[model samples]
Target: MDPLLSLFDPQVDSDSEDIIITETRSATLLSQNGSLPPECEEGNIEYKLKLINPSKTRFEHLVTQMKWRLREGHGEAIYEIGVEDKGLLIGLSQEEVNASLETLYLMADKLGATITILRERIITNDEDNCKARKYTDHRPHKCRKAVEVLVRKVPDDQQTIELRIAVLGNVETGKSTLLGVLTQGETDNGRGSARLNLFRHRHEIQTGRTSSISKEILGFDNKGVPITYNVCRTPEEICEMSSKLLTFIDLGGHQKYLKTTVFGLIAMHGHYAVLVISSIGGVFAGTAREHLGLALALEVPVIVVVNKIDITDNRSLTQTLIQLETLLKSPVCKKIPVRVETEDDVFTYASRLTTDHIIPIFTVSCVSGYGLNLLYKFLYVLPPSVSVNDRQRLIDSKVEFQIDETFQVPEVGLVVSGLLISGLIREGDYLKIGPFDCGLFSPVQVSSLQRHKVASRSVRAAESATLALMSYNNDIDLEKSVRKGMVLIEINDNSYGHKICQYFQARIHVLFHVSMLCPGFQTTIYIGNVRQTAVVVAIMGKKYVSTNESASVMFRFIKQPEYIKNGSRLLFREGPSKGIGHIVQVFPIITKTNDNSL
Candidate 1:
């Protein structure tokens, strides 16, 4: 047995908060020498000491069992060969291991899946154990080995899997450049040449800083090979050829554009966040820390990228890494920092990124392309935070599409691009879009749909698309009726109409407030894609609140009544004062009528 296996505690509670408990348990099980039946499995993992030979019926049963395990893990499963079900690592001979792998491949073939070997270790016993061996050979024999394999089923419905990653950091941290390098497959010239294509406006190019939210894509095929502009020449081509798509939300890092960054993070529904830090400059600047805090508060899984490695010296790089590790390990973050130096580290971390505690740090230089391949591999294997069942539940629920950007094309009429937070939206579906100054949703037809610049018939929950809207019933001007922060919801004839209101109550945590938060204290509030000024009307159960305090507060929008949902995340900020909370209750609007009798 491996010495590491001796430290394993089989009786430890599986529900512990430690994210790596699963991996540890797997390791411990693989090092044991006992065997148990497959029916005794308790988790997504399964063990097989060896499968060199099996009856036809047994093989079929094993395939069926693997199918069930795959379903439990949502199309992903792990298999430990040369390990017994009783958590024993009974190593297999080289021939036995080869035959077992071939059998596993056959099983995967039956389920239309692919397998990747994660690790292989040789188990060697000491001479004292060899002396007690009952083998025919008198010489001390080397023990057998074990292998850990990951089996991933190719999604049959959608050709490609989508993962949105919000890229955030402080100014000059190379967020845009890193994205450009990843998506365009071109190294930077060290003078902002790579980021030129990602810039939206002339001002951004002139200043060499992103001031608004931009997006770029990097695609990976089923085999985990990147399909960038170098191979496809266009995004549409990449989408057509790739089996997985990674959407990078390139957000501004400047303090002035912090609101835009926050909106991108919230509205985009990013599965993970990639925070870039400069090795030379370090994270001493408060903006980097602020960005990290925002991601943490939102509960977004983060992967830190220490950039500018080609330009920085060893001392500077080491110092920057130390600072980042300290922050991640601090009480506020409490993240387990794993420095990714090899492809193995990437695979291990990517498979476990959903735990929200493992923070994988990567060191890369856009100019020299150091560690870029490892980053791409990591992204290729990173599973989405949301599962298929969750998405299905949203699809079954009422449709709620939050508008993030509105545009009036020359001939296309009005097009609103946003995410479908719930339910399904088809091209011909008629929905109510609103909360204009009049505080009501008007009927509109979905004339067309486009995702990733490719025309599509429909969009599903958690998917982003631009929907062209046409006036229905009322002769509504879409440009005037639709606005950012508004929602397009499916109409239900049976229920009381959707509520719109200006006043709402929220339980807020004052993350940081320079002064006491009293009644009438106003700040810019952001809920989803909606950004509006709101004033605190009342503070419940408290005279006043300040930093690190919590209170239930009544807030009224300064403008019109906005369509807000219950339990929606709300972020309010004024200068350095920032607070994050969620809507707890909403008050309905009451209209007064003219009374002739009075």
Candidate 2:
């Protein structure tokens, strides 16, 4: 095993003498007696013999290198003191070690970070010889020690870290129950009592199944403690108290509501997906495999959860795990399944979840409250996939908000809920929202903004919120003009040429088509939050296409023109056929015709 991989291993004793060291060495660290390693390498881990008494230039260079390593590890890095470039344990004296640690603190201070000593182990003369022993005869002949320190930077922004997770699996897999237990801070009564609060409609409560997309939140403070109804009274309080928030998009698990589930997975921009499997039923009943395939196709990282473990025996649980492992390792889903059994497993798996192939499997029972703490810890440590650079770009770009759902409240006249895809939006800002019947945008004012039911003055990019809109045109009816899939864009000083399109060309790859796809085939296409029926008017270079085939197709919406952008991901489905593609070209609607005959 790689020595760095074992850094978080729970079984390894930090103070033991039998410490495992890798053959890899850092070329940047200066060695006393030996030369630098043959290959220079820089990564999350760095080695240093000691940092006591360095020149001014050398100190600046060291600080810069530390900053690079911290960024490489996503705001975290590990340093090994009293080690040479060739993995040699050249132990330092007690005085030298203290000075080295003090220098590390200085470096961290300069970099706006905090340092924590993870471990320390002493080395005697028998195990490894110190090169400085030959020169220092007046020092005491005591064992010298090496220290491992972790440096983490404080997040720059004050806004809470938000991560959207889509919860999906087959029906009756305890999806709602697990989320209820997680967010409500209450265990199940074994009769589906915990999930009652999450249901939206009477039909869902009566049938004990979710048919619509619902949302729940799990908040964690800076110290990683969960803040739920036990401590907070409302979602606003939870948001205000949390430093990190996990928005759970609870989607339906049945095949009948597959469209709604697909929309939730695609439109919500989920960073990760949690696939719940019932221990008694094992797998492959209704939509387990389908949900898994959809997640993979959409390029969403997945974590597996085996629910209702309190009812299953050991043998059955083992069997279920075996079956899941086989499916995950299959060709269709090439994922490395790591069963999380301890806190160490949670830390290791959460750190590597962005790798796309590592799938962590967790088993828990909401009724018995087994293995739920580990799950919560994993979520608390899970990092958002959106990079700092990407977020900055979004903030610098023009404002674009995709409308997902709209409402006409009694007090709040016209309210629209959706995601802010780019730029920032503040209360009382004037913007244009449209693509009405005439395919034109209309000016509107943002009366107010609410996020997670908490009223806020402003909402930034990649955050979900509801904006109460006031139409500037008193003659127009807001309810008749505004609809789902419309966008609210900020009107700049040079805004021009923004119109909706009825026809567009896209490059599509059919995932699976029962029959050949030809021209005039009608299907429901979902792009962002837009769901409309479109017919294939032309196939660029082919007469017909089949499963796993690629082609360029021209589609015309059956209804009015919709506002769509180029390079947007689109999913079209009809019956058992489904395809995923992106919009490559858009043709604007031409409403005016000149009379040439006159």
Q: Which ten residues in a row have the lowest lDDT in candidate 2?
A: 1-10
Count of residue pairs whose backbone atoms collide, per candidate: 5, 0
Q: How does model 2 score by TM-score?
A: 0.82
Tens digits of per-residue lDDT for model 2, 83-158: 7767666667889999999999999999877786655666556423546465334254576777767676635753
TM-score for each prediction?
0.88, 0.82
Alpha-carbon runs more than 4 Å astray in model 1? 1-44, 127-143, 493-498, 591-598
- Best TM-score goes to which candidate? 1
Residue pairs in steric clash, candidate 1?
Answer: 31-89, 32-88, 32-89, 33-88, 33-89
Each model's lDDT: 0.78, 0.79
Runs off by more than 4 Å, candidate 2: 1-155, 493-499, 591-598
